[model samples]
Target chain A: MNRRLLLVSNSTLYGGGYLQHCQQNISDFFGKQVKRILFVPYALHDWDQYTKTARDKLNSLGYEVDSVHEAADPVKAVRKAEAIFIGGGNTFRLLKALYDNNLVTEIRKRVLQDGVPYMGSSAGTNVATVSINTTNDMPIIYPPSFSAIGLVPFNINPHYLDHDPNSRHMGETREQRITQYHEELNTPCVLGLREGSLLLVEGNTATLLGTTNARLFQRGKQTSEHEPGTDLSFLLTDAQ
Target chain B: MNRRLLLVSNSTLYGGGYLQHCQQNISDFFGKQVKRILFVPYALHDWDQYTKTARDKLNSLGYEVDSVHEAADPVKAVRKAEAIFIGGGNTFRLLKALYDNNLVTEIRKRVLQDGVPYMGSSAGTNVATVSINTTNDMPIIYPPSFSAIGLVPFNINPHYLDHDPNSRHMGETREQRITQYHEELNTPCVLGLREGSLLLVEGNTATLLGTTNARLFQRGKQTSEHEPGTDLSFLLTDAQ
Candidate 1:
């Protein structure tokens, strides 16, 4: 379990530039060992534009980036990639592309077995979990399955939001939606990672990184909040 | 095409009691023709409790409600049903039950061919569309497919909400999610039916019935808002 993963809740904060908030952490995680990275931009509809934007951001941080879509063989590209980065858009679309290209297993093998550094934001971070059941995105497209890379034990609910007491809207709050998921699946713990929050994993150790606290939900248990810098390595070994 | 349908955005309003706000509309739509109503409580986790609650509400309104779950043969029950009501809960669970019971075609045949009156709120309204692609509920469980009843030509996004200008959340807005859906599916129109709003359809005519304006989205066009009482019958003839 020498996997290195950086799962960010969001690529950009409100009123912030693209990937501006997590640029330093991205550089620190990959470090100088990783020079070239393969980018998975399938979650977005406009693949060229998404890849260009991500490539520019990574290039500014002294790393060369190439999109997997440009490769003649996606599976082969994943096997030979130095590091992997998956951008955020729609989770269903992202997973569909991964399955469509038969790159799901290859990427998992590289990241988990080969110990390749992996990074994802939003939809990208979503697939790093056991399943995409807790994602906030719409089912814009149907993926082959909801099962993801299973890089982590518990499910991750990225861009987690607290309910506004004054809202007049009748839609279910984020908490209620997650509770419904637990009703169907009582085993996997759901980690509600708010914007600006991320989970950094190395081997069996998982650490909460960001300014705000991350909320945790498990069946028949009270939701507990953990502050930044808290050691969450125990979650890595918890039941799926 | 003699079909009768009442698609409600939500069962409850912001500050109103459960099913209280739409009681008059429900009665006026059914009138004296409907006496015994077949209730589909499959969307709810607690079918017995949900059926009881709905039965109490309908009984107060001079209608006898019997849950489809109590029927020895669910498909046959749909064939002889005078009227049908599908309550709101998780859309995924509702669609799964419909598929598992092989009632999707039966209910559609009853409503479309037999002219049986049909009513649904939230998830129920969602399943009335060609597909449940625009629902606001979480996908706690996966159905056989995203394909739905297709009682209507287009899709329904119930509990549709407007973006909060003051919020800092990075999650995509409801409008954005629907827009992404259009990117994949360009034919079907999407109606964002807000709370306290509903659509009433009889034969080929569909009318907006509520106090608030409903939003409409079509591919290659700006989202348009239509006020209550507007004729939306054209939507019933559009592509699925």
Candidate 2:
């Protein structure tokens, strides 16, 4: 009944994955005491691959691994687990599954009420938002639309670092997409997290955890630039 | 009828409303050559204010103005309108009305097929996306959620400069929100536009319009950081 959440931005098991940094961040930043890890394959790449890799990694970490697929089991999973790690994949799919499974409500309850040491990576982090419009997902075919778990007051835009030197696809810049978000409702805080970055939301406080810089936005204004040391919710709480 | 398409981000109007930049952006950007301006009040603001302001601006520009509501009589208003200037407001509402009024399909024909110079400021700019989720509006109250005119592939988050100077509220930073978008989708582009910034999609190519920066992203990786001079839809087109 005592569980902490572990959200991961990217899974080490995915192709072209960044493992060393993510693992180190998890082990060091979060207590090494993380005994069990849960994978919400909703956001995972190739559900089976994600599961197997997650299992192996958790096993290597010397912890139990569980994937939440229950139609309404997010609460049950969190209640029984010690550490939870939501992986990255398709945000809409993950969110849809969560909604369909009615896990969104439970995740909020587990985190806000239970203070489950949470670990959300990428889309996992996105679920913390009041909506998922902050995410990079296109929502082409169906509607992942803009609904979110509202775990955190603001929204999460994951994989939010500057461009990578190793890749070559030029898409809409992250800032541009976020600008689109701000265009709609600029009041909510939009978080941009880099690969290994983390936005830790504790009781009444959210902290930015990462080695890279992320931009903070409010409505039409851009707050200050934040690195690892930034207090994610200082100004947020102050303003509130 | 020949018309110009105006895209605006903010929905509030007059006396330092949420969309102060709406009127100014239009006048300063587009000269008096605009024959007529059509106002799109999408974000649920006072219609009278938006209409009055838009009409006054159009008069100042020596052009005609219509609130689109006028044409609600026959609904063929799209065909009769010449030069449309969509003011900043709720893009979701604007898109919904467009669809309900059967103006969405007409807009595409006029702007895309007929080569109308489409100009938008804030929320007006966002609805240009394939869907409305790219907007920055709060999902707290779900509007008649609908897809945009599909003028562009990606949804826009406009007025995207940085944090507010005076105001406190927080959770995820802007960067985190965009990163979350990237992590969730492989295709959707998040356009981060500053106050004066814009993404002009003409005939399939999207050009950056303004003096700020634009960021492109994809599946957890940032593609490029574009300054004001950068041309958009270069990579975005290829991705689509």
Candidate 3:
């Protein structure tokens, strides 16, 4: 399991430009060895526009982008890609396209077996985990399955927000939703990745990144928060 | 179509008790003729507890509650139901239970063909429409399909909130999510029902009820807001 991943909580922070906050991290992850990235823009409605935004951002980090949608043979493109990146949008739409293009297996094999650098933000980050069950996005479209790339053993709730004491809204808070998920699924803990936070996965070890702390939820266990430098290697272990 | 529905945004408002805010509406919808209410408590984890809570509340409104979970045959329970009420929790779990128990067709038939009064809150209200695609609940469990009980022509987004301009949360606003839904699905406009709000449908006429206005999302059109007593009959038409 030589999987290397950079799962981002969001593409853009609240007051930052596109990929502005994570530019240094992105640059350091791919480094000088990786010059090109294969972008999956299916999560969004407009593939060309999503691809352009990603390409422009990655270009500034000294990397060229080739979108999977633009490729004649998406599977071949994935097989030959130096690195892979999935952008944020609707999770269901993204997963549906991945299944439609037959890129799930190819992407999984590339990321897990070939150790291709895999990066995703928001919807992208959600799909990299066990399933897209924890995503906050609407089910605008139905994918063949909720099963995602399984880049990680656990699930991730991207763009996780804390309940405001002053909020008048009565909808389920981020914590409550994750708890309900635990009621249904006993294994594979869920990580609530707050905005601006991310996880850097190298083989069996996953380290929290960014300034904010990440909250972890496991079945029948208390939820714990971890700081940026904390090693989340237990998540990658075959405990379940 | 001789269907009647009382789809509520939330069971309880921010500062209200369970089903407190909509008790009058519930009483009016059920009336003196409908005595026993067949309760579907599948949305929440503990069916017994959920059923008890609902029973206690509706009992005050002069209605007897018989939960489907306690029935010898669930489908028969729906068949003999004078009125149906599905309380809120998680949409995916509720839909999955409906599919698993083969109650979707039974409930739809009773509500549409038999004209048995139907009422749902939050997750429950979401499943009453074309599909649960616009629900705010997490997809903790995957149903066979996203296709829900088509009692109505459109979809309903329960517990809808207006995006707070002052909030720093970068997640997709309720409006943005519905807009994304429109991109993939052209028909069946989505109604964003705010807390303490509901839609009262009788035959071809659907009236907005409660204090707040409901937002309507149509494909290739600007989102519109409807006040209480507004006739949303256009939504029930076969124009889609």
Candidate 4:
């Protein structure tokens, strides 16, 4: 239970491709000795393929990747993992299975309580937030549960900027959306993050590591902007 | 043109409808001597229908409805109109044409400075805001321009709640969409008004009227709820 872990998202992967932010700075957190990697492929259509890819990534990093289809055995397999990386795909599906299987709580315990270094990518990143208010996916696929891993306190609006000013359709603008969140939520902070950006939290240090910009909005306050390479730990408290 | 005026929205009537909100509330604001009513179907698909409908509505209200398709015609049309109503439909399209034809500025002159009692609904309601961030349409159609007639501050998310909750689609929730707005603006309140609820600003006295619930969200603060059968004049900054 006392080890390092990584949680990567697979929401926006094309078809078959190499890992993304998962492998980006993962080693930096768990060190070069990560082993016994467990892959959560609930988001992909065929879990086998995503599991294979995840296995390859962990293998390249000198770790054994185990495909965990059953939730009851995640902690058992992960008890010895030097790091746990939950590969992402469709977030609603992944979170649903996690909620049903009761693995999310274990993952949370492994990372936060057990002091495992956890890294989550796209959908995996989404799982860390309080809710998915910032996701691009349709709310149509409402999961039985609304709570995520709750590692972070705000909602993540992923694929943050898809609005093209040239489109003829008149829909709600991005800013209007965050306002809608403010209407319903009094505490949950909605974080708008573009691709290639990661909000990393390490005990007392919350840092923004990536290549894109991060924006935060709350009711009654002007939006605060955070460029790449900004420390975000302070936001964890205010964001919650 | 210096005079009291009203603007009604017709974006909902599909093509242009013969009846508009302009004539419905004309005598109430213009007083018993409500002689001379003018209708502006600026949102019509064809300029002819817009023109023809205006003429008919004015004739019904015992006044003259003139066509303002020409560049300087709308300026002259509002000049002669004792009570003007801007009908709704596709606010983006309507306001874009008005701005292009240089009609928006003239309408503002007659309403804001001239003391026109501007009244609008749907898209009619949209143009009254500084921006149109509250529309429910998707981005299938984009308007050429985006500035409104500027009768009110903040954005109005009309038809505030989707009638059905069983259906699922991938767009911001009513509250989620509005929270997106708070991410960009803190002061310009986002008002989520149900169909019957309306915010009426008269000579600086803005009142909430109708038979439903309306929500007011201030950035940073949770959310303020208001119900129907209540006067919204207390929130007005410009006292009559």
Best by DockQ: 3
Off by over 4 Å in 1: none
Ranking of candidates on TM-score, top first: 3, 1, 2, 4
lDDT tens digits, residue span B157-221, model 1: 99888998887887899999999999984558999999999999999999999888999999888
lDDT of 4 by residue, A126-232 (tens): 78777554544322123555577877656666545545565332335566666545644354776777655566667656676666677787766787778977877
Residues B30-52, candidate 3: write the lDDT tens digits.
Answer: 99999899999999999999999
DockQ of each: 0.82, 0.06, 0.90, 0.02
> Which order, best to worst by DockQ?
3, 1, 2, 4
DockQ of candidate 4? 0.02
Candidate 1 docking band: high
- Residue A133 of candidate 3: its Cα lDDT? 90
Q: Evaluate model 2: give its TM-score.
A: 0.56
Second chain only: TM-score per model?
A: 0.98, 0.77, 0.98, 0.76
Residue A139's lDDT within candidate 4 is 23
**Per-prediction count of colliding residue pairs?**
0, 93, 0, 62
> Which one wins by lDDT: 1 or 4?
1
Candidate that beats the other on lDDT, 3 or 4, i.e. the better one = 3
Q: For model 3, report DockQ.
A: 0.90
Predicted model 1 interface RMSD: 0.9
